[model samples]
Target: MSRRSTRAARPAGAARPAGCPCGLPEPYDACCGRFHAGAAAPTAEALMRSRYSAFVQANAAYLLRTWHPRTRPDRLDLGPGTRWTGLEILAVRDGSAFHTTGTVTFRASFRGGSLHERSRFERVDGAWAYLDGEFPD
Candidate 1:
């Protein structure tokens, strides 16, 4: 089976709660949902948060689409049992609406553990795209 299929299935068209999975105070529709529906994220931090939400929802298409094409993987597998729990934005640098490049450091908690990484983003075609990340020691 495809790794994507191994993930827990969410009910199709299920109504999501007002709060977004990315730990943002705003509703899903007002936050990451708009990004998933084709609106470009205004800043790198917004893209990072929305990417976290996509992972939580197992939305691989959104993940791939938002990834920088040059570094994007041939395919993605949301491997089984990795339940994303929460996100905490630690810092952001340069990646504003006017900046072409930026970085976001965040802590993302999951069922088994948490990941702390500084992710890099760049604007491609006037939209923010995830480039890569580094795990802090």
Candidate 2:
């Protein structure tokens, strides 16, 4: 006999989650949504997570706003068909509130493949901003 437990039926009053695309246990609104709404991310990892969520939500304005002005592009094109699937934070360094600069190493998976980037971040105007990145082999 199989020991697998069957699923329990939910009450009609129960709300279902579409799930936060950022891979966090919390819902989108509680997690990355605050950052998209203009709240500054407290850490470099937080900014990186919110940035990943932004890509998933296609909030180009938020992405642009969090990017450093010196390195920010003139325009952003998210493309038509690329779908981001998941985000995995690999490493972090010096990105705390006490530091003015930091880096986050992460893997962002998509429909076809994944992007591995060591993204640099710096404080601009007292807020953390994406500065640039390097692709490591």
Candidate 3:
């Protein structure tokens, strides 16, 4: 990713307390840092936003860095006309053994078009991180 994209991605949204903007009652680090940290995300939602940031910032290191070894891709593409607008937390639940999960819904604008998605997250090593999530339109 380009430095411009990386720098642009980090500053678009308000600095959240590592918590779910969806009001899921969790901190960002506790909810999403695990996958961001190379562990497993406790849910699918957390994985989504962090991935979004990864794309916006063109954070190839972070993208490759956080991907699960089983399914990690060789490289990521930060497509043209991508911009982040805001984030919102949706729901959360406890997973098995020091693992928690959450679902987050968010809106973003790219190429002058708006998009929405529900992201998931997971917890690992007593911390949360993004796992993998699907874009549900």
- Those runs of model 2 whose alpha carbons end farther than 4 Å from true positions after fitting are 1-19
What is the full ranking by lDDT, best candidate first? 1, 2, 3
Q: What residue runs in model 3 are displaced by over 4 Å at the alpha carbon?
A: 1-50, 92-100, 124-129
Task: Sort the candidates on TM-score, descending order.
Answer: 1, 2, 3
lDDT score, candidate 3, position 50 = 65
Q: Using alpha carbons, what is the TM-score of model 3? A: 0.48
Candidate 2 structure quality by residue, lDDT tens digits, 1-137? 11111234668999654656777768888889988987889988889999999898888999999999999998899966889987877788889989999998888999999999999999998999999999997
Model 2, clash count?
0
lDDT of 3 by residue, 1-137 (tens): 00111123356576744443323346545544444566554344445556665565556787776555545677777666666544444333443344465555555555567666655455545544455656774
Over 83-108, each residue of candidate 1 has an lDDT whose tens digit, in order, gives 99888888888888789999998889
My TM-score estimates for the predictions, one after another, are 0.86, 0.85, 0.48
Model 1 deviation from native, Cα RMSD in Å? 9.5
Best by lDDT: 1
Candidate 1: C-alpha lDDT: 0.88
